[model samples]
Target: MLAGFAADLVVALHFAFILFVVAGGLLALRWPRLAWVHLPLVAWGAGIELIGWVCPLTPLENVLRRAAGQAGYAGGFIDHYLTPLIYPPGLTREHQLALGLFVTIVNVVIYGMIALRRCRLRQRSRGEVARS
Candidate 1:
């Protein structure tokens, strides 16, 4: 039972990590310092998808489940849980690549907008200083 509970906690943490990977750039826009933390996560998340690397969490969770006398699952979290809800079919390599591409595109757009806004603010502040 204790192992099962630990496995559940791992699952929750894994899901939260996925959410952070997907949308954490938005948070970084509000807190620029967070980029140092978020960028590495983005890279790891995208690499996992693009390179087809299994997350270590998968095996850890599986071991926990097995220790609890439950049958360990065979694949990553997305393959077991998310695929059913989102894809209704098996997750293929192309789909994984697409997910990586999607993450890259989203962060690019978010950071691009942040850069544009900062540039405009700098220009506006300079104009005000000149007028003063």
Candidate 2:
């Protein structure tokens, strides 16, 4: 019972991590310090997708499930659940590449916006200094 609960917890945490990797850049816009945490996560997430690496969490979850006397699943939760939802035809290497690119593009856009905003603020401050 405890093992099953642990496995479930791992699955939930894994899902949350995925969400953070996907959307964390927006959080960085509000709290710049969060970028430190989010950037590495983004890189790891993209690397996993691009390189087709199995996340360690997948095996850990499966082990827990097996210890609990439950049949372990073959793939990660994304492979079992999200892939089906997003790609009815099923997840292919092309889809994985697209997913990785999507993450990279999204983060790049968000960070670019943040940089542009900072530059504008700096320019406005300089203009005020000049006026004074």
Candidate 3:
């Protein structure tokens, strides 16, 4: 009941953070302030994989699930779901490093574009203002 609901909410939040990491970059183009939140998520994604650290939310969700008499998950979702395809054989040191680099690169590229776009917009606006 309550425990199940809590677990579900935790899972949803976890998924949402993943979305924020990717989408937040594009969103930052329009609202640069969002970079504050998005950048941290990028770092977190990379750091977690590099350090082989599980997100705190996973344990919280697992505890709720267990309290609800549901099964608990031992590893992070990526390790369980993506590792099969991404890692294939096993999560070797190189594979783990690659995963971290992948996340960091993807995030940087996204945010980099947003920053470029923002700079263009600002410059354009200034040019117009100068003319007026």
Candidate 4:
């Protein structure tokens, strides 16, 4: 029972991490310091997809599930949870590449917006200083 609960907790944490990897830049837009944390996570998440590496959490979750007498799932967390919703059957190398690219592109756009906003703010401050 405890193992099953731990497995559920891991799954929830895994899902939350994935969500943060994809959309955490929006959080950084609100709390600029969060970018320091989100940026590394973005890299790790995209790298895992790009390189076809299984996340460590997947194994941890599987082990916990097995300890709980549950059958463990095949493939990574994305394959077990997300691929069904986002992609068709049989996730291929190409699909993985696409997922990685999608993640990168999304974060690029978000960070680009952040940079533009900062630039504008800097310019505004400069203008104010010049006027003063």
- lDDT, candidate 3, equals 0.74
**32-71: candidate 3 lDDT, tens digit per residue:** 8888988988888778778988779878877988898877
lDDT of 1 by residue, 15-109 (tens): 77878888998998899788888889999999998999988887888898899887844355643785344333588999899999999889889
Instruction: Please report how far candidate 3 places residue 102 from its true position, in Å.
Output: 2.3
lDDT of 4 by residue, 53-73 (tens): 988988888899899888844
Clashes of each: 0, 0, 0, 0
Q: Where is model 2 more than 4 Å wrong at Cα?
A: 72-89
Query: Candidate 4: what lDDT?
Result: 0.84
lDDT of 4 at 129: 100
> What ranges in model 3 sit over 4 Å off?
72-96, 121-132
Model 1 Cα shift for residue 25 (angstroms): 1.4
The 0-to-1 C-alpha lDDT of every candidate, in the order given, reads 0.81, 0.83, 0.74, 0.84
Residue 84 CA displacement from its true place in model 4, Å: 5.5
The TM-score leader among the candidates is 4
Q: Which stretches of candidate 4 lie over 4 Å from their true place?
A: 72-89
Q: lDDT of candidate 1? A: 0.81
As for lDDT, the candidate ahead, 1 or 3, is 1
Task: Give TM-scores for every candidate, taking all chains together and pairing residue i with residue i.
Answer: 0.84, 0.85, 0.71, 0.87
lDDT order of candidates, top first = 4, 2, 1, 3
